[model samples]
Target chain A: MPRWFYQLASPRWCYQITGKLLPGFAIAALLLIAVGTVWGLAFAPPDYQQGNSFRIIYLHVPTAYMAQSIYMTMAIAGAVGLIWKMKMADMVLKCCAPIGAWLAVLALATGAIWGKPTWGSWWVWDARLTSMLILLFLYLGVIALNSAIESESTAAQATAVLVLVGLVNIPIIKYSVDWWNTLHQPATFKVTEKPAMPVEMWMPLLLMVIGFYAFFAVALMLRLRNEILRRERRAGWVRELLQQQRG
Target chain B: MNNKATNACHLPELKSGEISFQPGRIFWATLVRELNLALRRRSDLINPLVFFLMVATLFPLGVSPEPSVLSTLAPGVVWVAALLATLLSLDSLFRSDFDDGSLEQMLLSPQPLFVVVLGKVLAHWLLTGLPLTLMAPLLAVMLFLPAEGMWGLMLSLLLGTPTLSLIGAIGAALTVGLRKGGVLLSLLVLPLYIPVLIFGTAAVEAAVTGLPLGGFLALLGALLAAGLALSPLAIAAGLRISVSG
Candidate 1:
């Protein structure tokens, strides 16, 4: 077990390490997502029923998955910060908010676009759509709460509590389709049960999922680096790094 | 043996008799004091009521003068108006005390803070929430809800609005110190208020359609009980952070 993961709790060490890793992750993310998009858009077979409109699912599903997972990630980071008083965990939670909100927006936009073609309306008051709208509001609430406060730590703690409370909505959003006679369709992808799609559709989706994760990792590292530098601006290593950049 | 008997004889004196009042009496006293403060602030008492009435009256102009259309939209319109009215009342629940020094004084008081917060919340429910419940029957008529659903509407409001107060207290406590807190307060609390809104409207809708009100009212009552038990603790914790920071 390399010590860098634990050592990164210190702002100076995290700043130094992520500075090295950011470029690599960025390049890798760009390459992978590009390949995934080309493969998904050009090569993947159109659905026998929905045709080209089904292509939106490639972006919609992955971002929706990321939106939900990132919230859980933020909440877990918040729990860690609350329990162990870890500065890195708090930093991660803060950095996660805007990224999560943007991802939520992407999910909602893609969802609405998908709805227009499939359901003949831009929006519907179905369970899945309603719950996802609520999720977007929860993200906005956390981000708004975090920014409105003057003190960093107070903002962090307050937003953390809000995030935990808002977690109540997550399971509801997931099961809304099942619990109600929603206009939206039931989930097609399940881990335990066999997938509904043939290998062609699922493979592109799988690649896109991996690409989304890589993109998230790259974005998180960049944001975390910026946060660490801002918090550690007075440190000697930061001063040296600044001098090096200036040179 | 004689010393033991002497100690036993002194046991009642050793246990302080001054702190033995019933908890219920203390709660009542706190609630009374909160109510008195609320009444002394006349604007707080009247403003939310006026806002509620204004909102209910606006619907006819915004929609149509036709009774059928108004009656059809009445249940949702009234419940949404009430939710907004409750939200307006909620903004002041902690903001004023927080702005002045009163919240600090209460926090420093030897009384348990949860009891104190709960007392304020109850006073809020009585002064603002109770009035809404009383006025609901009149508004229900204006919105053209069936005459029979009036009682059911009142019953549902009675059970439902306290939960609104409790949940709103949590939001108000969280944002008490922030500048321009009103919009954020709505954003934070509205999602939590969904179950109440859903069941409340359903109760009215059921009554209008001549269906049974038992299930919806039961759900509303359960939600209120849960809010009463849980929200105070969250509000208290939020209060400490808001004040300390």
Candidate 2:
């Protein structure tokens, strides 16, 4: 392994690196999201069918994207922790669940808000929406399992196994849900599958998605720093760092 | 210490000393042991079935009891009840073994944990899932499910419940070390159960409407195949973490 990768296993190195990277990600996330939101809401042309109600797409798409990506991130990090026995990877996995769950909730809420105008209901049981809801539950399950176990390492390992299992099942669940939805509802006009969006609309969406990724980085790093500190509080470097911060 | 030494000497020499990789034997031994234990504790075997029956009963009482209403809801109601009953029974899957230190021994044994986990899950399916499948028809009748859908209900449950047991075992193993694993187990397992429930109910519903059953049944079979292939690895990993951690 490369030096930097190996160093990541060291809590002190991880904390230092995240501390350095956090501000840039935070600033990028803020600027991009703010600019993207304004551009998407005001500058982008309204959907011919839905009008201004389509603006919720700015929030919904990014968060929905983030929710799924964060889950993938969590599961991949968990696999890394399980395979490499990397403590920092475990911390990353542990910190990811809440953020992912919240993003899923945000996606669902925004989807609901958007749904009222587009689908004429707060909830449509659309396949994508239902799968997103299930994804939220999956995140919650990881969180629940993590907190339920008394030992942190054990909890990490257990949740890693679970996240991996969830990873495998996600595609199956999504497909089954899609099949089930189609069988019952039969093509309810998928909102996101519109004919190629005008650049003005899609460009902002792209920005928002990137912004969400940056924002997720910021959130994950912040949580990861705290997790590293908490789990490594007994180590000499942590004590030194604590004293250094105090002084 | 002296008594321990004497007891060790009382065993047959080959039985005491031999440590060979006999996965088939380990699988059967674990399955038989689990079956034996489950049979001895008759309540553990019966409780989930009773729960299944009662939960199915709730649908008719809670919803409209009219035959038309229940017959329409029967497939979903029966599948949901079976799913819950399997989940209800899952907590005890590894609980007693973990408590009794046999789980630890199983982990330490020369045989692969995969075989042991598969065996245990098979035994669990036999005791809980199979019985649930057999009892489902009676519940379906009470719920007024159509005669045509009966084959679909039983076949779907037969195909799906084993997958349920396998997947639920992962949760059960992960939570085996925890005291209040019952609720948490459901929380962890139920989301994963969604696919099985979808396919299971879809099969029955298709049968009810006289749609082609092959697709749904085939999908259910695919899920069971995947579950059989993948779940034991997860179950073994979970068991090790629970036991060691």
Candidate 3:
């Protein structure tokens, strides 16, 4: 085994490491999200067209970005688990699913809330939202498959394959849905694409995006630590740690 | 047929790992065995077609039965129903083999796993996808589909559904080991099916609108080619994981 890999694969090492790292990310998430939210909501100028409803972009864009990023991370972790047989990678893959799904839900809810004011309805088959909706289904599918399979290693391998397949399909789905939307309806608003937003608007958006990712990191570490403890409960170190905590 | 596995096990020559590079022989045997099994349970073969027809019938009842409304919706209606029928029949693709232990034998065989998986998917496509494609014209007429679009609907289905079987096989192989995997199989596979569904339906929609549909059909062909190249390997890996775990 490689020297670095051996250390990286150690559950005790990761648990201890994350314990040291979690507070920093948690604090960063709190400060950045708080600052970005207030600045965007109260200070940033309203959209020239959609007006105040556009404020939801701060929440929607960041979550939508995190939702896809977390899925990609899960896929990468799953691939590592399969190729290197890293048990920690499996924990990372499993732990990321629910958080990714929640982010997708938040993005969708915000999009729907935003859509009601701009598009005149709660839901339109807008390409981005439609693709995000399908993404939510994809996340749910991974969660469902993981729960259905009883054995840990087997479930991990199966989900690894599913996630990779999803990774291949995502771009194709996005393109096809985009094409379908164009054929059926005119193009709608894109948060990332604008007529060169003044820095006053985008600065807070960037902050919120970074904040959401920091929050994601904090949540992921918490879940990964819990999973490590649960899966490694039979290990000697885990037993000793449990005894110490009990005392 | 279940006994062929046990009978083959007793043949000393077959026990050697080097069974020559005769994938043709293995492929034929697997396909024929699947066909025989499918033939014996004739209902399994015909049920999807029946389900397809019944679902198409419900559209008329659930929606307006007037011809104008039906014709406008026909392409989407036929395509979505066909996709569902393919999914309904996917549950049995690997379940019986897994239950009967032949799947384990195939896994143990030195012959390539992908070839045998291809044979099984071929057999599945032959029974389910072909029949649905053939049945589409009738269903299209029943729905008052425009005369010009029938060829596009049938051709798109013919090209689209084998891809469905190929992709769906990966899902089937992954779940075949579980006690209750039918719904979970759909959950796992349906999102992957979206691209094929989109292109397939788009072809017919293009035909109805008098637009060139060759591009859409070409995309479906590309998806099928990709599915052919990739799906069996994924299914083979999934099967190994499912069985060993």
Number of the top-ranking candidate, with lDDT as the measure: 3
Q: Which rank order by DockQ, best down to worst?
A: 3, 2, 1
Worst 10 residues of 3 chain B by lDDT: B3-12
Clash pairs, model 2 backbone: none
Query: Which of candidates 2 and 3 reaches a greater DockQ?
Result: 3
Put down candidate 2 lDDT per residue, B47-110, tens digits, no spaces.
9999999998888779898999999999999999999999999998988778767678779877
How far does residue A179 in candidate 3 sit from its true spot (Å)?
Answer: 3.9
Fnat per model, in the order given?
Answer: 0.53, 0.85, 0.85
Between candidates 1 and 2, which one is better according to DockQ? Answer: 2
Per-candidate TM vs. native? Answer: 0.89, 0.94, 0.94
Q: Return the top candidate by DockQ.
A: 3
- Runs of candidate 3 with Cα error greater than 4 angstroms are A173-195, B1-18
Cα lDDT tens digits, model 3, B1-245, are 45444325322255445667668877887787777778877988889999999999999999989999999999989988999999999988988778878789889977899999999999999999999999999999999999899889989999999999999999998899999999999999998888788899899989988999999999999999999999998999999998899
Order the candidates by lDDT, highest first. Answer: 3, 2, 1
Q: DockQ of each model against the real complex? A: 0.56, 0.83, 0.86
lDDT of 2: 0.87
Locate the minimum summed-lDDT window of 10 residues in model 3 chain A.
Answer: A180-189
